[model samples]
Target: MSLHKDHVVRWNGISLGLGGGVWGGSVCVRLLGWTQLNDLEIVLLLALFVITPLALPFVFFQNKGPLFSKWTALVVFLQPLAAFLGGASFFLPAGPLAATFAAGWGGFTGLLALLGLVQLCQMRRRHRLSLTELCLAGALLYLPAGGAWMVLACWGLQPLGFGVHTDLLTAVHFHVIPLAALVITGLTGQALHNRPATRRGVCWAAYRIAAIGVLIDPLLVAAGMTGAQITSLPDLDTVPADLLALSLILLTLLGLRFVVPTTVSRVAQVLLTLSYLTVFFTMLVAGTYVLGVTTGAWTITIAQMIAIHGLENALLFGCCGLIGWRLRTGQESQRSRRGEPCAY
Candidate 1:
C-alpha cells in the first residue's frame, strides 16, 4: 500500500499522456465539425478532459498519507467509470437518467476538489502553504462549487429563471476554469521549485492583484448572468489579466536565469520556457479581449476566446508544464539517490 515517488511520477506521466491524447482527439473532432461526432465519441471526448485533470493534484501530493494516497488511487481508477457513465448519459433517452449521470460526475469532481482542499488545509496547518499552494487550493475549491452549479443546470433546475445556459456553463466550468487552475498550479510549482531570484514582495503583490482579478471575474460573470450591471465586468477582468501577465513575465525571466541547460534536456527546457510564455500570452489575449468587449473595439467572439484561452492554453502550456514537472521530478530523484544536493 506504500505509494512510492516513482509510482507517483509514473501516474503523472500517464495522466499527462492521456490528457494530451484527449486534447488531440478534441482537435480532430473540432476540425471534422461537431455534428460529425457520434454520441459516444462526443461523450468520451468530454469525459477525457473532465476526468484526466482530476488526478493531477494526486501527482503532487502523493506522499501525504495513507488515506490520502488511497483516495488518490481510487479517484484515478474511477476516471474511466466516470467517463463512461457521463458520456453514456448524453445518449440516454431518459432525461432523468442523463441527469443522474451528470450528477454522478459532479459528485466525483466534488470529491476531487474536497481532497485537494484537505491537502491544502493540511499544508496550511504545517505552515508550509505558499502562494502557489494557496492559488491551487482556491482553484480546487472552485471545481466542486462550479460542478454543482453545472449539475443543477444539467438537471434543468433553473433557480429564479435566470435563463442560464446549463450546458454552456457546464462546459466552461469543466473545461476552462479547472484547466486554467491546473496550468496555473503547474506554473506555480515550477516557479517555487526553481526558487527564482525575483523580489518576493513584487511576486506577492502581482499574485495578489491577479488573484483578486481571478476571484472577481467569475462574480462578474455571475452578475451578468443575473442581468446585473455587466458594464464594468470587462474592465474589471482586465485588471487581473494585466497583473497576471506582468507576474508571469517576471517569473519567466527568473526561471530562464537559473535554468541549467547542461543538466536538463533540450525538450524539457523548451517546454518549461514555453509553459511560461503560453500563460503570458493567454493573459495578454484575455486582457485584450476584455478591453475589446468593454469598448466595442474588437470583434473577438466567445467561441474564439474559448479556443485560444481554453483549448490552446491547456493543450500547449498545460501539457508542457506537466511534462517539465515530470522531468524535474526525475532529476530531483536522481540527485536524491546520488546523495547530492537537490536544487528544489
Candidate 2:
C-alpha cells in the first residue's frame, strides 16, 4: 500500500487521543457506569475498538511514505483488545477451566511479547516496516492467543514453568510486560506520527517498558485488580523494587525534558508529558517499592486511583499532541526566526 506522509496533518491526535482516551474512559464506564454506558461512551469505545487502530494504518496508506510501520497498526489495535479481554475476564464466574483459561491468557502475554521481539529483529535486519510495527508485536504479546495460537500454545502452556518460579512470573507478567509495552507504544507512536521524526535508538527503550506498565493500569482497574493488590505497600525496602523505582525516576527525568522548548508547548501537551512521567515513575516507585516485595496497607483513595489511571492514558495521547505541537511549533518558530516562507 502507498503511504501518505502528509495526508492528515493533525491525524496523530485522532489516533492517539482515541488510544489513550478509550483506555481511561473504558475504566470509568465499566466500573462506575456499570452496564449503562451512554452514547458518547459507546462512541469512544467503538472508536478505540475499531476506528483507532485504523488511524495509524490510514496514515500509512495516506502518506505514500512511512507514517507508520504496518506493525504499529497490529499492536496498537491488538494490545487494547488483549487488555480488554484480560480485564473483562475478571468479572466472569470463577471455575477450574475458566481460571485455567484466564491464567493461560496471562501466560500468553509473554509469548506475544516474544513475537513482538521477533518483529523488531525483522525490522533491524530487513523488514520494510517502521517502528510502529512493534505496536502490533506488543499487542500480540499481551493479547493471550489471537496473535498466533501455535505460539501461544508453545509458550503459554508452561504454567508449571511460571508456577515453578512465581517471582519470575510476577516480574514478567505483573511488572515488566505492562510497563515495557506502554513506553514502547508511546515512543514509537511519536516517531511514526512525525512528518519527519528521528529514530530514538536504544535510548528510548525504558519509555517502552514503562509504557507497557502504564497501558496495563487501566486494564487492571477494569478487571478489578486494585493497585494495593498489585503492589503491597507495607514492606518498602527490597533490592529489586528499589532498583525499579530508580529506573522509573531516571526515565521520567529523561522523558520529561523532552517537553521543553522544542517538542511541545500547549498546556494540554505539557500536562500530558508531566502526567506520563508521573505515572511511569509512580508505577516504578509504587509497584517495585511498596507493592512488589514489601506488603503494606494498600491505599486506593478514589483521588489517587483516578489520578494514576487518568494520568498515564492522558499522557499517552498527550504525547501525541505534543509531538504534533512540536512539529507545528518548530516549523513556525523556524520560519519566523529565519524569515523564510512556511510550508503551504
Candidate 3:
C-alpha cells in the first residue's frame, strides 16, 4: 500500500493476506473447533478478526473523513451481524417482530427509511450527482442496512415484538427493504436519463408489485395453491428459495453497470455481477436441497445464501464510483476539444 501526501493509506498485500488469515482462522474455529491456542494467539486472533472484514474498505476506499470512515466501519462490521441475525431465526422460536403487527412492520419500514437517508447522503460526488448515482447509492445501502435489520429480525428483537415466525424473516426484511430501496433507485435512474422517469418509475413500482407475488406464493402453498408438499431434502426449502430471490435482487441491481462508459468500468461490472452470481448460484444449488432434491452431509440453506447476497448488494457503490469516474473522463475529453472547462 502507498502512503500519499495527504496521509491516505491505501490497501497493500500484507493487509489483505493477513485479513484472509483472520477470516479463515475464525471460520475454522467456529466450524471445526480447531485451534492452536495461547494468550498471544487469542489477542492476535481478535485483532485479525476485525481487520479482515474492515479491510475491504481499506482496499476499496482510501482516505476519507471521520464520519464517513466511522460509517464504513459500522457497515463492515455488520456483515457478520447479518449472518448472526438470519441464522438466529433457525435457532430461535418464531413470531411477529413487534407485539402488534402494525407496529413491528412500521418500525421495520422506518428503519429502512433512515437507512436510505444515510445512503443518499453518502452517495454524492464533488458535484453533479444524477439519477443513476442515486440508484447506485441506493443499491449499495441495501446490503448493510438490510443486513442490520435482518440480524435484528433473526435476534427476535422487534420494537413492537409482534411475535411473527422466523420463517417470515427473509420475506419481510430481504424482500420488503429492496422493494422499497429500488423504488428510489428506479426513480433516480429515470431522472438521470431525462426521460421523465417513466421506465424507472415503472420498474421500481413493478418490484413492489412482484413482492406481492412473493408474499402470496407462500400463503398459497400453505393453502395448497401450488405444490402438494411432496417434500424433498433441503428440509427448509423456503430459505433457499427466499435466498435466491434476494440474490436475484442483488444481481439485477448492478446490471446497468455492464453498460458503464469505460472498459475498466465494464470489466468491474462483469466481475461484480459474477461475484453476485456465484452467491446466487450457490444459493440455488443449496435451495435444491432445501427443496428436497437429495440428502448430503452438508447442505446450503436459503438464509445462508441471503447473507451472501447482502454483501454483494453493498458493493454497488464501488461500481457507481467507477461510473462517475468515466462520465468525468468523457466530459473532460469533450471540453478539451471545445476549448472549455469540463461540464456536462
Candidate 4:
C-alpha cells in the first residue's frame, strides 16, 4: 500500500474525529458527572461510540470467498448499533431501561458471534483458516461471553466482591475485550491479506496461541467475578493468569514483527506497532495488578489500574489500531482498483 498524501489526510481526519469525540467525552464526563462513570467507564463508552464505527469498514472490505456472506453485513451493522445503544443506556438511571439496553447489546453481540462461527466453519471446510479468520473467530467467541457478563452485572450481580464498581466491570467485559479482538482482527486482515503465502504456518501458530490466551484470560476474569475457586499451581497462585497474559503478549509481539505488512505508511506502521506494545504493557500491568491483589502485597485500587491500563488500551490499541487498519485497507483497495500490485 502506497502512503499517498490523500490517504494519509483521510486517515488523519478519521482519527481526529474519533479522538476528538473521546477527548470531549472524557472532559464532559469529568465536569458534568451526570452519571457515576469513572475514567475507565468514560473511555470505554467513547471507544464503543468511536472505534466500533471504524470497524464497520471491515465488514464490507474484508469479505472474500464463502467465508463471509450478506448476512455478515447485517450482523456487522447491527452490532455497533446495539453497542451504541448500550453505551447510551449508561446515561439512564440504573433501572430496567438500562438493563434492556444491556440485553440488546448482548443479544446483538451473540448474533454476530453466531455468524462468525458459521463463517469460521465454512472457511475450515475450504481449508483456508488464516490468522485473520482466527482473530475473527476469537472475537466472535469472546464478545458474547463479555456481553453475558455485562447483563449479569447490570442485574446487580457481584459474586466476587472485587471492590470495583459492577458497572465498570460490565463495561470492561462488554466493550474493551471485544473491541480489542475486533481491532486485532482488522489489523491482521488489512496487513496480511496481500502478503505472500510464506510464513503462514508461523502466523497461524502465533494466532492460535494468542487467540487461546485472549479467550481464556477473559474467561478466567469471569470465573473470578463469579467467585469460582480457580485451581492454582503448587506455590504459584497467580500462575494461570500470568501465563495467559504472557502468552498473549509474546504472540502479539511475534505477529507484529513477522506478520504485519511492511509496506504500510510510517504513521500506520508506528500506530500498529504501538498498538501491540500497548497491549503488552496493559497485559503486564494487569497481571501484576492481579498478583498484587491476590497476594495483598500491594493495595493498588481498581480505579488506578483502570485509569492507567484501561486508558492506554482504549486509546493506543483499540482506537489507533482501527485507524491503522482503515488506512492500510483503504490504500490496498485503491491499489487493487487501479490494477497495481498491492502490498496486502
| TM-score of model 2 (CA atoms) | 0.44
TM-score of each: 0.73, 0.44, 0.36, 0.77
How would you encode candidate 3's per-residue C-alpha lDDT over 196-294 as one tens digit per residue? 333356554554443343333333333331132334323344543554355344434433432232223344445434433443454455455544535
Put the candidates in TM-score order, highest first.
4, 1, 2, 3
TM-score of 4: 0.77
Candidate 2 C-alpha lDDT tens digits along 237-296: 233344445544544554454433334336634644654465465655355334533454
Better of 3 and 4 by TM-score: 4
Model 2 lDDT, residue 73, Cα: 39
Which candidate, 1 or 3, would have the higher lDDT against the true structure? 1
Candidate 1 lDDT score at position 95: 56
Off by over 4 Å in 2: 1-87, 96-115, 123-237, 265-268, 280-344
Residue-level lDDT tens digits of model 1 in 1-344 = 34564665466556646655654665576567753433323333443454355335533363466667767766665655565555444445435666687677677778777877777868877888655555555555656555555455446566655433534444454434444543454345444444544335665455445544553444444554444323433444455445445555554544455443423556777877787677767767877886787778877876676667655555555556555655765676688799987664
TM-score of predicted structure 1: 0.73
For model 4, the stretches where C-alpha displacement exceeds 4 angstroms are 1-23, 65-69, 127-131, 159-167, 182-186, 189-208, 224-240, 259-261, 294-296
